[model samples]
Target chain A: MTDPKKTVSVKPDADQALKARNGRNIALALGLVAFVALVFVVTLVRLGANVGNRF
Target chain B: MAKPAVLSPDTPADTVRAARWQDYFQLLKPRVMSLVVFTAATGLVAARTHIHPLLGAVAVLCIAVGAGASGALNMWYDADIDAKMRRTRGRPVPAGLVEGSEAATLGVVLSLLSVLLMGMAINWLAAGLLAFTIVFYAVVYTMWLKRWTAQNIVIGGLAGALPPAIGWAAAAGDAPLNAWLMVLIIFLWTPPHFWALSLYISTDYAKAGVPMLPVVKGAKETRKQILLYSLVFIPVCLAPAATGLGGPLYLAVSALGGLVFLTLAWRVFRSDAGDAADPRVADRALYDVAEAPAAEAAPAVEGKRPPPVGGAKDARNLFAFSILYLFALFAALLAEAMIGIRALELPL
Candidate 1:
């Protein structure tokens, strides 16, 4: 049986890997935010053109 | 020398950690959101008026985001109970992949953004309905009804059933009779669909202190309720054809699908009752294992259960068929709408 109280320490290499993974995740989130903003801007421009045409 | 801190598998790390992108995505409940998007799109297409494709796409995106927002909020609030249940323990908040506070903040931000963007792009009516759907799922169902009563799914299904109407409103700027009929069909379908799942996983609800029908009222009564709801769902599904929203193909699909669903539900009811009547059978062993005291029987690890037979098989069959029934019915309606087929009149 394993000891319940033992602290499992991450190796330095493993810790570096985890940090790198997290950094990639942050970058992906930022990219998604940019895409959503682009969609919003395009939608606004199209709607504005439609309104202008109607008038 | 100071002893290192003891940590259980369930415990979060002491250090603050950046959430992985997958962790945030898991909070959105992507599977549920996919179903929401599909049903909403079907409703939009089935509407009488033609909407600009761009606006239609935006409306669908807004509804999807609103649904995801509700799912994230539900995960945040139910993290405690989710951690206790085997099926949900791997969820982001429960698994310590993401903080509950972070999930809650994401949910709130998404909810506001979706509703506001929808109102600006489409009409306020659809936006309002989307907002209400989020609140109903997050607050009414997750916070209130889930723990309070066994009738939770029966009432709380309204939120899930409203997306079609929201889609119709977005396209036509008003909900008509057909939209309401779609809502009614989904509302009636939810109890049986969810109850079938609950019958097999009642122990999870019991462990989590959730008042699912199977746990609160016992398996026999829950099975009977499943049958009763399926009986009601069949007619409601067929009603769309009568209102001219569906055509011959839609009517045929509903009839065949309803028959299959009802048969499976009946089999489940009989199997459950059979197990209850005789506890010595191997089928009863599985049921007993689920409800047995945690001390007596070790917690059955997820995905490790033996191949289900008898009542377990029946419940799983009904659950699977229920999803197909809804999909077939909606797909038929969508096809008829896109093709411009008129409803075929039957000889009285």
Candidate 2:
């Protein structure tokens, strides 16, 4: 198990592996987009709510 | 659904299928995450602080992700034992849907992400508590105590208990007595809830060589301990109302629910819950196990002596009811706080 070569690497050409890889890529993209959006929105809410109290 | 790549002797070493996204999600232990999210959200709301909904949502997400990270790490570490038991055999790493190294990587990555995001978006105190909870569960509980002591769940429960405290900190910028009261409820509740489960299914732990209370101390002692914990747990359930953490609704739920919980514990104590030989669940198919009448004579699986003619329904009742009772307790507090019900103040 310690040997990296022991566990099979993802066979990207196989149909199931190909589907899984595509699905994972899509999920990663969506998650990254969501994270970016969340950070932007949280920034707006925090800064906007506090803008009036800024010294 | 894709088949999980179970390796047969004939199967080549290098021909495993890629893990699906669902497997990755299962690695998060989403059912447990739901409980964490609910309790944490309730704590934030009960604090009655004027945090922006967005910030509150972010806090809950951070707590959920941190909890999921901890669970993934546990699955990674416990894969060997998990595979041996019927209960946890289907988990991603043990079932071969996800590799142990991948689970560890996901756990580490998510742990960092959740902690960083929490610190950036919420108070550093909340972030710090979340990080501590992850470490406590992953390292202290999973790596050290689980195998070492019968008091595993008792101490390890603090990891589960701290989420509400984290949520309270996120909202109020500090956790106070009332917040810790919430933690104490869960901490006290954990032993009875888990021990009741261990009563019926302890053979699984024994097979896996896990040092569960029942496995280590024997079922009779485990039952006695469960009752003892229940004795303490029920009163603590009522403490929130007296401590002003809960209101009329909370009081009603905790009181009425506490009575039923105690009665179940009493039944579990009086009954021969864990004394009989438990059913060999590993030999039975999942559907067979589900379809078999829990209280009736469970058919022997592969000549394995089934648990005494009638299974221990008292233990099962307490186990099932414990989940609902805890949910009701938290829901009452959340509802009371949200609906603006005043707490019952004593004129001492």
Candidate 3:
């Protein structure tokens, strides 16, 4: 019978891929934060006139 | 629902790591978070005499984080039992991608940070309630009542229902009767909502040695309890109309919803023990799985296994509908509030 230990192969290349994935994730997260901030600023600007009129 | 695990496959070798940030975001139970946010938002909105929108958003965010923290803590503590239960076996913790310690740490840190930030940003009343909610769910519900008693969900439900009141307190610095009315609606809603689920997964819970009502008591007893709780829930649900939170629209929808809910509960209660309730529910022998090893090992051949009663299909349909029932019921309330329809003066 084949060895059970060899059943799962976790290669070093997979680890390298994981590291690359992690880097991309960090960049993407920062980008999303920036986008959200930009949207929040825009919404505030758009709503400012209406809110001032209300006051 | 016993489909494939959401994250992990059977073979550990064939591990799929999602290369996106959204995948990590899914670790937070966003649907439950939304419900928490909605109820809290409704509370804050209702209580807004004159509050800044930014602070209100912060309050909602803190409540959302607190709810997420509780979910993470629950996943952390119940990881073992979750692995055994079919419904929860696919969760991140049980599926083995996320470590239990990591979940616990996230829960604890988030719990503290959310409450502390809320206290500093808002009033102390809301912060105190948030802190109590975290402890109640994580410590009381998760650590204590869950494994020990059939009444766990019934009593521990207050923790889940606190967010609205906490929101109200955040806005007004004091939760009055109207705020408590919101809490009561959810409190009464929990049993029928959860019991309907337990009706399906009684076997899984039994297998996991959780003393859920359906596991400890027979299905007949659980059904009777469901009917009893539902009878009480329907009236409490209408209390919002009296308390100025609901109007004609909410009253009409909630009354109709209550009738349907009662009908479903009655169906479950009336079902004979065997050859009923739907296919997903198999006939289970109600053994006291919570008792000590010595007590549980002794087989009570004398206590004959009751025949399965109730339409499992009916129960399953009711369980599914209960989720929508609560959602629709709350949506009606939101509709009424948004329309600015005031309640009639009820003859109390």
Which candidate ranks first by lDDT, i.e. highest? 2
Give the per-residue lDDT digits (tens) of candidate 3, residues B241-305: 77777778778878898889899888877765322333323332222122323333456455453
Give per-residue CA lDDT, model 1, range A1-55, as digits (tens). 8765555556854675577577756876795797588577757766777888897
Candidate 1 structure quality by residue, lDDT tens digits, B1-348: 101122224455543234457668788889889889988998999996888887888899999999999999998898888877766776777666577887899899999989998998788999999999999999999999998999999999999999899999999999988898999999999999888877777776887899999878898899999999988889888887778788999999999888899899889988853233222222342223334334224555666544334586577668777887888888888888888988654432
Weakest lDDT window of 10 consecutive positions for candidate 1 chain B: B1-10
Please compute the TM-score of chain B alone for each predicted structure, in the order given. 0.86, 0.90, 0.84
Stretches of model 2 off by over 4 angstroms after superposition: A1-13, A52-55, B1-16, B280-311
lDDT of 2 by residue, B1-348 (tens): 334344333335355457778789888889899999999999999898899888999999999999999999998899888877776776777667687888899999999999999999988999999999999999999999998898999999999999999999999999999999999999999999888888777887898888999888888888888889889988888887777788888888999999999999988888888777555443553323333455255555654554442436678778878889999999998998899998775332
What is model 3's C-alpha RMSD? Answer: 9.0
lDDT over C-alpha atoms for residue B324 of model 2: 92
CAPRI classification of candidate 2 = acceptable
**Distance from true location, Cα of B309 in model 2, Å:** 4.3
Q: State the lDDT at B270 in candidate 1.
A: 89
Recovered share of real interface contacts in candidate 1: 0.09
Winning model by TM-score: 2
Q: List all candidate RMSDs to the true structure.
A: 6.5, 5.4, 9.0
User: What's candidate 1's DockQ score?
Assistant: 0.29
Of the two candidates 1 and 3, the one with more favorable lDDT, higher being better, is: 1
Would you list the clashing residue pairs of candidate 1? none
